[model samples]
Target: MDKRPSVLVIGDLMLDRYITGTASRLSPEAPVPVILYQSNEDRPGGAANVALNLVAMGCDVTLVGVIGEDAEGELLLSLLLSPHIDTSNIEADSQRPTTSKTRIMAGAHQVARVDREIASDVWEHHAHTFLRLVRKMLRPESIGGHPFDAVVFSDYAKGVVTEDLVRKAVENARFCGEDGIPVIVDPKRKDFRAYKGATLITPNVAEIQLATGKSVGSNEEASTVAQDVAERYECSVLLTRSEKGMLLCDKENGLKTMLITSRPVSVSDVSGAGDTVVAAVAAGLARGLDLEAACRHAEVAAEIAVSKPGTSIVTEAEIIKREAAA
Candidate 1:
């Protein structure tokens, strides 16, 4: 890890379109929900948000993901380009549409929402193209020929993070082990099998419970599952327990778990907090921070993320201010 180390973000890219309005009156046309009557905002989401957070934190970031050539895709690219993050790794697929999650908010409350996206597995040809794009982005010429200090896998489980890509990346990271590049995964799947060799996997309480088939009624249960995952997957884990905080377990460190509490905050929206967490951890580790230090940094970043509205992007200054106060 080095100061100002570069990071690479891979997985799904999506647009979070928020339609905010007051819902005082119910819609007669639709029996299901009330209609919103105010303007809205759009933001980057999924893997794109992870890159945005990294860029906002002043880390040189490269985003590799698939998006359609549709309007949403255009918006996603435009948003990424406006920031300091690099979009050279973004690949367009004509066959699929760019994923978008639209939330209709009535003032501070969510009224109704709809998701316009696809969840099919990546076709073989497109997978190959994405692999090529990844290889290109990792090349020195494209990204300064320097190896990324950390690789963040922000999996929304929407299909961009294919098995082939995961295998290739893990193998590459293992080969560069002494260089000490940490590969972090923000996993969505119930099974941690696919992300076997990742340096760190961040899964929420529910995800951990489902993945490990262990009931998580208490911290004791969570601790047990954390160690179970670490030993079974042969990797470290940072289990996020929402209000209960997080637990870090490393196989090398045995079954002992380290608990880190999150900074209390008035949560406005938790849409992209996971992305922020993954970004902060990756950035911290890449900058040579210890695992505990990195998890704390991520927790602070997540607190900032939750305080903002919608799929908000946490800035470096905000994180620094929170850190100072903490």
Candidate 2:
């Protein structure tokens, strides 16, 4: 029997394109510098990046999201089709363009970014289809009586994570029994109510303030806010504070809060760091780690992710090496 944990990632999917060049001179018409065309590369972004992170950590991952029937979408799918990842649930819609972020990089620094996407909620039929897919994936008989261990909602506020979708997913997970699978959400919406009933939520300091209108500047403040949010939502909350580390408040097993301090490392690009955190945490939970231990694993994963340039992922071997070094 294959006992490896399986994770289902659902939400916005995008492609990140990087155009690297040298900007030695300014433009003639405007003040912007002229980027000497050098090289360009594309990688999976958004929810797809989360799936990648999970796969790199040795988890069986299934990615579910909406993409357009366009070239960019094809490219994104191609990049995501890996031996450990199942993309059978990713659907294509012709009415919308695939979400993409094109960054113009001058050497190692990003000068500007161009985004092409539709911010509106997915069509009703699409949402219905997505819900059906989720139900099927959660059904034990769907995969020879082996169900997913965890479900992650990687919301980028990019239209795929609707309120209905979140609610339905939670309900379906609860219906499966076995104490119900853990539903984790990396929320971006201003309204925290949309993510209610999730087993856990990973929100950064800025997101907490934006969603709850409470500024968390100190460790004490972060603890208070995390507790308040967890109580309000009746779920655990992992509040990520850059540099200060992460504060986790688990409501499921008493209102206990643990602050995992961040490691001191030379920071590079922080792009996709949140995705890495959520992915690591979800993989840990799926593998039967408690919330605090899972969060500590995430902290380490995030440290490794930010040390590299651009959106990056850490493999299980990298994590082991870091652990041995520590």
Strongest candidate by lDDT: 2
Off by over 4 Å in 1: 1-3, 29-33, 133-145
Which tens-of-lDDT digit does each residue in 1-326 have in candidate 2? 65678899999999999999999999999999999999999989999999999999989898999999999999999999788899988989999999999999999899999999998998888899988887676664434443688999999998899888888888878756466788999999997898888999999998999998988998888888899999898889999888998999999768788889888988888999999999999999898898888999999998999999899988878887887788
Report the Cα RMSD per candidate.
Answer: 2.7, 1.8
Candidate 1: the clashing residue pairs are 21-38, 140-145
Q: Which digits, one per residue and each the tens of the lDDT, describe model 1 over residues 225-252? A: 7888898888899988777778888755
C-alpha-based local distance difference test score of model 1: 0.82
Give the CA lDDT, 0 to 100, for residue 309 in model 1: 84
